[model samples]
Target: MPANRAFVLNSRPSRETPAGPHNFRYVESDIGEPGDGQVLVRHHYLSLDPYMRGRMNDAKSYAQPQPLGEVMVGGTVGEVVASRNPRFAVGDHVVGSGGWQLYSLSDGRGLRKIEGGTPMQAWLGPVGMPGVTAWYGVNKIIAPQAGETVVVSAATGAVGSVVGQLAKLAGAKAVGIAGGAAKCEFAVKELGYDICVDHSDADFGDRLKAALPDGINGIFENVGGKPFEQAMLWLNPFARIALCGLVASGYDGTPTPLPDVRVLLNTRSRMEGFIVSDHMALWPQALGELAGHVAAGRIRWRETVAQGLEAAPQAFFAMLKGGNFGKQLVKLVE
Candidate 1:
């Protein structure tokens, strides 16, 4: 059998994902032959997101949870090494749900042939799901107006970074709330947010309140623990909050405490939570616009690439802990 390496989730993660050697097992397996209309591809880049942590459990959600003893669910960009489908040929680059493995076989389902105008890894980051999520959150959910103050937590991450920049492009004053000085600097300096507050600062709440004295018109929420609680105080009447992910409590078994609804009622504001899957029908238009922005140099992105497939599990856990600088991509092979 031709051998291939894969990252397998041994068990559901608790508060923190245990090391790969403990919670994840790497093993060599047969490189199963491609069936009719299928292609055998070798992975180059794998996109890691916090939502994957929620999928690790068997619990029901918007999408089917990853089943135990199965290869972990992820999006990958790969080059076709063998093809049985006429639509794809050997040496073609494709992006699809290829999982975390050195080799993947796909039957053309949900696969897109990629071009070389930009880096192939981009299909897994900006101009992909993360970028699509930001577009949906801003245009459909928040709808920030010119002069409105828009804030995004986890601001330097793939999704949040796009959210903030899109808000700026729409003429809204964007403020990002990130984890530390470095992330905050990136958000303000590189991504070009109006201001960025570090959530780790002892006076973070005060700083946020001071930054938005007239109140926030829209908030693209990514981190939902203390930041969500504090953002509530600054929301303008009829303000909209686009709740994306709750990375702060996603990995744990403990129930995430719901934020007080009284604030919503008292301020007459709206808070709506969403996943990208809910807006699938709009993906083509959204991705087209995002791709245009990326190609036009309007949207800036940064990626931290890990060296190999063996690095995915460790890189994923590190990302969950806010250790990654930007979009984390694991390179499976050359």
Candidate 2:
């Protein structure tokens, strides 16, 4: 049998010392057989998300930390090369938490069989967790109304892109806050955002406020820091904030302080922080909604892919630094 190449976590990363390639060790092992009730998957794509950084630490979190001396945890879409499981068959495409490996052996628990309505890679992106995340945050938390103003940070990313489109679909003015001019332009021109502000600019706060003459009724906060803090200054009465991610804090573990304490009380704003997996029952509904939007061309998504499994570590590090444009993924197979 051909060797199964994988990256195993060798050490834990901390707030003071961030993780790097040194924390992982590459190994080659035999591609073992899958016995009865098991399936062998050959991963085609692996998702690189910000949450994986949190899993690298051994501290208490909403979920268990990634165990050391094992394959690093991640989402993957692949083909079942071998299956003794009755639910799965050879040549079947699947999506699951398959980790950072060329191949994986599974008992077919969380693995979802791909039905081919949408593109396969999208199961890791727009029609998948990111899409469901956007749908839930916008509809359940942010709850934008017609003609209201909604804002999303990291506007061109997988989740943020979908967030903006969904807000627009709700008849709200979608405002995007992204890193550079190029992304800002894409948010407005392609994603149908009303106005997209460049957060990297020196006068970003002023520009953001200027773009929102009506103030913010809803916010899908992906990157919380100075950008989110600036956006907070213009919260409208009874505005809603869906706290999806704090990209900066997730990496280094330093909290970004938003000092405008009185706004929540003054505006009666509601801020809800969520983990998408917690609401398992809502996923089917949310995914169906998202897939329909995608089918109708109401939702647009993008991806940035790295070449191979060996490049997963560096790609992940780059993605954390905002080097990626949309959904950061590694193409594990040709």
Q: What is candidate 1's CA lDDT for residue 90?
A: 93
Candidate 1 structure, TM-score to reference: 0.96
Please report how far candidate 2 places residue 63 from its true position, in Å. Answer: 1.0
**Alpha-carbon runs more than 4 Å astray in model 1:** 14-21
Note the Cα lDDT for every prediction shown: 0.87, 0.90
TM-score: which candidate is best?
Answer: 2
lDDT per residue (tens digit) for residues 224-255 in model 1: 88988898887789999898988887555556
TM-score of each: 0.96, 0.98
Question: Which lDDT tens digits does candidate 2 get at residues 1-334?
Answer: 4689999999987656678888999988997999889999999999999888888888888889889999999899999999999999999999999999999999999999987878889999998888888889999998888999999999999899999999999999999999999899899999999999998999998999899999999989998888899999999999999999999655566767775779999999999999999899999999888878887888877889999988999999988888999899999988
How far residue 172's Cα lies from its native spot in candidate 1, in Å, is 0.3
Candidate that would win on lDDT: 2
